[model samples]
Target: DAGITQSPRHKVTETGTPVTLRCHQTENHRYMYWYRQDPGHGLRLIHYSYGVKDTDKGEVSDGYSVSRSKTEDFLLTLESATSSQTSVYFCAIRQGIGQPQHFGDGTRLSIL
Candidate 1:
């Protein structure tokens, strides 16, 4: 999957806390995206970056933030963790438009 890796594959945290998930890639893709996968909602985009320091909000970005300081790393942070925010987060990287994205396994987060 183009050497994509998500850190802390599993995480359990309490409500009202802050949590951060990391996605790192070795392929030097110019576009990266963060998505949350829930049982019924399917994959919902949270945020995305087109290039270094250039990011935008997505469909489900209410409580989440993302940063891409370098070509190989993207960070997704939950401002304040909540039960509804618990889900499997996936990171995707694409070389450019019209190309297929390679995804990391995912980060399973639980909020109690």
Candidate 2:
């Protein structure tokens, strides 16, 4: 089983507010992923890291950014969150792309 934790399980913020969500892993996995889930849209990748200090943008990376200074932690930041960004954000990690992913409880971010 994969062990992960996402902070601020739920949040309410105003439009244009700055927000940061954190993902922590205890398994010391090499690949970490950030995704946002919305109704009908399914899950869309935002950013991912292959290793510490080596991160890459994913399909839906716009309006979002990511950082990984340590192997066990990955951070996703919204410089200016808008209502369009409101959704459930999930964090995942794995050994490889084809490998199974373990997910966090998710952060329900709402921008009003």
Query: In the order shown, what is each candidate's alpha-carbon RMSD?
Result: 0.7, 1.1
Specify the poorest-scoring 10-residue window by lDDT in model 1.
1-10
Each candidate's TM vs. the true structure?
Answer: 0.97, 0.95
| Candidate number achieving the greatest TM-score relative to the actual structure | 1
Please, what is the whole-model Cα lDDT of each candidate in the order they appear? 0.95, 0.95
lDDT of 2 by residue, 1-112 (tens): 4789899999999998899999999998999999999999999999999999999999999999999999999999999999999999999999776888889989999999
Tens-digit per-residue lDDT, 21-45, candidate 1: 9999999889999999999999999
State how far residue 51 of model 1 sits from its true place (Å): 0.3
What stretches of model 2 exceed 4 Å from their correct place? none
* Model 1 misplaced regions, further than 4 Å: none
Give the lDDT of residue 16 in candidate 1.
96
